[model samples]
Target: MSDQDPDIWSGIEDLWAWLDSHSPGDGQQSLLLRMLKLSEEVGEVAEAVIGAMNRNPRKGASHTWEDVESELCDVVITALVALRTLTPDTREVFVRHLARVRERSLGPGPGPRPA
Candidate 1:
């Protein structure tokens, strides 16, 4: 996962700026709207997963696993953008949280054991 990619965050910031310019909402409202977008993106991921799995009888295998992967990327991008909306220092916040999660899950070692 290229979560550390500078270009990804740069693109997200550009998108956030464009969105803010177009929508022109207050801070709290903007944050709420951004947060809500996460759910929308998450739903798209679920749809893609179902399509890839051929779960829908009428539209069997309508989407590929690649499509599901793209949708999941969208969900991640949406989540990161929402986090940025809450604070300008989203990278730091994310890195800190990731560290905590790593410590908890990996016990401060080389990392979690492979399954």
Candidate 2:
């Protein structure tokens, strides 16, 4: 973790910059909107899962498991974008928060996560 080069995090930052440049609204407005978009993305994931499960008898299996997976990825991307919207140092913020969460969930001696 020594190097934080132009990788996924860089891409994440680039994505935020791109979106921010394209957006017409104010920074605060866009940040709020991004958060709402994350929620919408999450809802889409639920919808995709339901569709994959054919939960709605009326419309048997409208989505494949692959569709569900794509929707889930969208949710993650949307969430990361939202986090980026909230802070420019999203990489550090996320890493710090993730470490805290892992430490809280698993003790100090927490080893590699179960595969």
Candidate 3:
């Protein structure tokens, strides 16, 4: 993954800006719609993976692991789009969420707290 290119949260910010410019009416887009779209992208990834893994390579049908990976990226993009639609400041949200997860993973620092 290129550091120059925005990661998922940064992608969300970019998507939010695009939506801001386009002004998708009333901000009433359904979450189900976004999820369904993401699912479709993921399905493509799965299909390509299955083809590459199980079927013999043919003359015209060139399905490879790379194709599956690209489709998986599309699924990630779709997910970022949905996340941006839900939260404007995805970076901050992600940072905070990450901090919480880290804290949980690390547990409370050695203090007077009981085991």
Top TM-score hit:
2
Write the candidate numbers in order of decreasing TM-score. Answer: 2, 1, 3
> For each predicted model, how many residue pairs clash, with residues at least 3 apart or on different chains?
0, 0, 0
lDDT of 1 by residue, 16-63 (tens): 788888777798888899888899998888888899999999989889
TM-scores for every candidate against the unseen true structure: 0.84, 0.85, 0.61
Candidate 2 residue-wise lDDT, 15-73, digit = tens: 89999999999999998899899889888888888889999898889999999889987
Question: Model 2: C-alpha RMSD to truth?
Answer: 4.9
Model 3 TM: 0.61
- Over 4 Å off in model 3, which ranges? 1-11, 19-26, 55-62, 99-115
Question: Which window of 10 residues has the lowest lDDT sum in candidate 1?
Answer: 1-10
RMSD in angstroms, all models? 5.1, 4.9, 5.6
The number of residue pairs in model 1 that clash at the backbone is 0
**Which candidate wins on lDDT?**
2
lDDT of each: 0.86, 0.87, 0.72
